[model samples]
Target: MSTDTPPPLPRQPAAEAARATEPASPGIAGVDDTGVPAGGGDAAEVGRGFFRALFDLSFRTFITRRLAAVFYVVGLMAIGIAFVVYLVTGIVEGVGALWFNPGAGISLIVATVILVPLFAFLAVIALRFVIEAVVALIAIAENTERTAANTRR
Candidate 1:
């Protein structure tokens, strides 16, 4: 029997793909301190610009509103994993058996299993709220900066 290769998969038109990949015009790109596009700046300059933009009031608020739920879920997952590690360590070290008497061990484990997740959920919720508020404050500062610039103009 002769071996045969499969036909090539469909592909995007080269001209269309090239246009999509081209960088934005300088007018649309953010200017670094040196008056060049941020993409052309040195690593330190770019880093500073990124942080500045991140902390800008409007941007910060936008990010916080859009990402708070995602961050909260991630925090909860992290705390849940931490609780698992703690439980494993306790069991491995015989802390449960040593600290609790008779049926108390089972009860303690049950309580821990339930309470750990509840605490983690509550903590994440609080953290999200705090982060959102901080971001909002930063956004307000950014808005003030813009207003000042516009007034000056």
Candidate 2:
């Protein structure tokens, strides 16, 4: 035998050599590539992520459903309060006119007779609107609560 070592064995083909050099892709035994695990973290993280997404969706739905009605009611109450202030101011001015000039008392009397009934009608309507809005808000709350309970189940 010769003292020098023999040359190394022949090199593999390019494709085979490349594949052999690289690590094999990881895989699940019973599942496809799409079903492979994330390689880190506990299973409970999946459940937590699902719940967070669900809560976000529910909150968005609730706001979308009630936002219009909530704004409408708020607008109605604001207008109603403004009207009440106008009525009060009108009455105070009329009183002042009557005190300073008795001749204007007849006009004030006529205005009171006409405007008091109109304002009363408006007030009644505003009260009804407020009551309806409150009822609707309560109904929405109950419905949302029921939906949340059902979703939990």
Candidate 3:
């Protein structure tokens, strides 16, 4: 037998693939929170399937990809809550000290007003990238599976 590698599949832009897929309806039954189809499995199927996959010893199916969107949203919300808490603490502390040291009080107030949002924005951007990276990896895995399936045919 000849020892030769097959050529790689051609990369197509998603816009081109969009033409092949069915038009997206607002509410798809088997869709994940990320709005992606959950492998065409409905709620009961997902529940049972996820449970089975969760216990899968061979580790074929992935649960992280399905839950990544939820984790991302939760992380963002946590940062937002922390931002509010920090802002409130700064405001209270700064205002409380206004009577003793006007300059320092004003400084604290200004820093709180400017820095709280700045830091939160930075955290959000960072979280977004981290989540995106994870999602990207999941997508790569999925694409690899698709390619493998096609190659078999």
Best by lDDT: 3
Candidate 2 backbone collisions, by pair: none
Residue-level lDDT of model 3, residues 1-153, one tens digit each, is 876999676588777887668556545466655545656557898688889989999887777777877988999899999999999999999998899999889999999999999999999999989988888887788669868998994
User: What is the C-alpha lDDT profile of model 2 across 1-153, one tens digit per residue?
Assistant: 676878777678788888887756555344344332243557698556546645794553233222445665666677667767766666677778888886686577567657865876686577667765765675577567768998994
Q: Scored by Cα lDDT, where does model 2 land?
A: 0.61
Q: Show where candidate 1 strays beyond 4 Å.
A: 1-45, 48-81, 89-95, 98-100
Instruction: Please write out the lDDT profile of model 1 over residues 1-153, one tens digit for every residue.
Output: 666988686588888888888877633357443222346658898677667767897653234433556776787678778878866754544445646574666666666667766776777778777866766775577568668988994
- Segments of candidate 3 deviating more than 4 angstroms: 1-42
Clashes of each: 3, 0, 0
Candidate 3 scores a C-alpha RMSD against the true structure in Å of 9.4
* TM-score: model 2 vs. ground truth: 0.35
Full candidate order by lDDT, most accurate first: 3, 1, 2
Error at 74, model 3, angstroms: 0.8
Q: What is the TM-score of each candidate against the true structure?
A: 0.47, 0.35, 0.69
